[model samples]
Target: MSDSNRTDFTNPSTFILLGIPGLEEDHLWISLPFCIMYATAVLGNFTILFIVKMEESLQEPMYYFLCMLSVTDLVLCTSILPKMLSIFWFNSREIDFLACFTQMYFVHSFSKIESGILVAMAFDRYVAICHPLRHSTILTNPLVAKIGLAVVLRGVILTPPTILLARQWPYCQTNIIPHTYCEHMAVVKLACADTHISNYYGLFSLCFVTGPDVFFIAVSYTQILRVIFSLPTKDAQLKAFGTCGSHFCAILAFYIPGLFSLLTYRFGQNVALYFHVLLANVYLLVAPTLNPIIYGLRTRQIRNRVLHLFTHKET
Candidate 1:
């Protein structure tokens, strides 16, 4: 009997990725928005990088963190979108077992790094606003570099265990993953072996890796708001709000969809499977596409520099 027909444990060499379950027929059309989002993510992030690189006045801990954010957005989206587009456009669905695992790791790891970057950015804002005089001294270039390295290293070190634990399972069940990409839990569910550990570990990684980030961001913003409200002048208060507003929106863009996706998957079993899959893609894609617009286009310094470049080129 073939592996699919056999009852004993087996590891399939390849898995079939069902692009969007019930929405398979709509994939060609669906790719349109996804394609646009990916393109925007690429163009917008590069634009931020360009502005930060070309404008010396834009060099600060915040912009440096923005650079890290742009790069993470690029990698995070690139990790899955290209393959997802393949599935959408060309109906290419077969992924090697190893490739599937690789994709799962990249998707999870870079996302963790992105969350870390958001935390770092929040801390930057907190320091800048709450301790203005000490902002430069506290977040010096060396410290910024270390912060970047720490976030990057955390993602790299922490994400592999998800893949490792899942890989140990024998694929004695169907290798067909009814999702757009090789999501970690989706892959784990394919294992015929008991997956309580894998499932528990998934929750553990989410809590351990992302729980602190969310908490830090919450605390940072709480202090930031307290400082903002205490400003003597209304103008100063509004100005502070203006500066942090965009950052806050970017935070919402990252976390809200993400939290919804996680909750829906773990609890909302009655939710349509396609909804869950689309929400998964949203957390990964929407933030990347929106961050550049939120920060690069909205922030005064970066916006002014972007305008400077455009005006100079036009002249």
Candidate 2:
């Protein structure tokens, strides 16, 4: 093959993920907190899944959506953290190209699924609040199945193309990923090819997928707010807000850090690298860790079921 052709075709066999910069001495210290967070996330999400499955009375759409969210959180955290923990604990940052791409796919796909589930949960709330009489009819077993299928399909279809495009690029340049995990853009930027298309497509996908979900969620909540205020009693409004408060916290936990990280990556070039990386890690880690806590505390049924189960076990 010609030199030019070989140069174009050559890609690195592996990439290195540079875990939290300037904290090499503190990797053990940093990992202590991360390990705690990961364990909490796994346990919390598992507890949600177990409770949802065991408690027959919790077989409604809201809990079903919670189950989906928990499963997605479990998968998302597992995809990134094991490798990251290894990096932190053992300094094992070398990841094969295929493995890196695989991680990238899961991270992005599960995120999309999470976004879809949040929107679905919002819709569940909307129906329950706005059309209480028809909620069961509207969000039936079949419809829930369809929504789950669509969420998975959306991720499966939309995410692979980005990975495929990324794979085609030659990685003749350095393959050191700055972030702790295999983030899509971080990996794409390492390619020696023109990255404009990949970057633009990512932004486009973000807008096309998450934008609509956020918009619909906003619309759903707006209508929900309208309904809550229109109620005759102040106590009724308070009760209604209490029901949604967990989901609201989950949404904020997931999106705010995410948007901040993206904004910093694009616009805040003056921001410190460690701060950007920290925000990126926070975006992935905090939601999963806090989701179960949020739901456990704010969700009356989940809390009751969890306490009952533990109390029964103790007795």
Candidate 3:
């Protein structure tokens, strides 16, 4: 028998995820905290959706963007939580090749979609604040729908090429993935075939996705700031920026760590495995958890609508 084929028979065709290597011994300690974070993330984003939908007062471009953001957060959390919880709660590490690719695809797809949506939101805010006289005309319902369609198309198209490139590579080597979820780069690295194409796509993906999105967001905020500063009334300036504070914070939380991780990994920085895993979890959790809190706290109308719903339900 060939020595290479001598892998453990029971775990063939799939790999067990080691899951944040050094902390495996203390897995129990983290389960409760992760569970709390997951629940809060889900419930918080769901509340945002509920508040947006039930409140007619929020039927505007900004609220529409907020609702889309909430939905993206829900999908993003779902993509990571089940796999992570399974590893933590049951110590189950078996994920089939197909399943792993599927997870990677959705994770990548939704993340890209979220980035696009944030860009769209920035545009909405820019128009609303910087060009108030023409905001309603430019950001009509049809225009928003078209932007949403473009976002979906961008994500759907960009994701498949990465998945196909990863799958085409031969994986005659060991399949042990180091983390809980199926990270594309990590999975591609396991392949026995040449991964130069995957690496190229990886770099291109970062530049193409992150570069333009960040540029648009920065420009939008700059214009927003310009308009706010031009206002003579302090109350007007405060109110204008107030509308964007939550989104800006959410964007910072989502983008900075992600870029840091990407740059560090690409440059061969020896980041701790746990740091990567923890940051992934935080990036997924923090945006969702904060989206609801930021919007709900900043926007009085949403707060009142949620309270009214609860009060009506209780009575």
Tell me, by lDDT, which candidate is best.
Answer: 1
Residue-level error in angstroms, candidate 2, position 123: 0.4
Better of 2 and 3 by lDDT: 2
Clashes of 1: 0
Sequence-dependent TM-score of model 2? 0.94
| Residue 183 shift from truth in candidate 3, angstroms | 0.8
RMSD in order of candidates: 1.9, 3.3, 2.5
> Against the true structure, what is each candidate's TM-score?
0.95, 0.94, 0.92
lDDT on C-alpha atoms for all candidate structures: 0.90, 0.86, 0.82
TM-score of 1: 0.95
Candidate 3 is scored at a TM of 0.92
Q: Candidate 2: where is the Cα deviation over 4 Å?
A: 1-9
Worst 10 residues of 2 by lDDT: 1-10
How well does candidate 1 score on lDDT at residue 242?
A: 86
Q: Write out the backbone clash pairs for model 3.
A: none
Put down candidate 2 lDDT per residue, 185-234, tens digits, no spaces.
Answer: 77887788788888788888878998898899999999998998898999
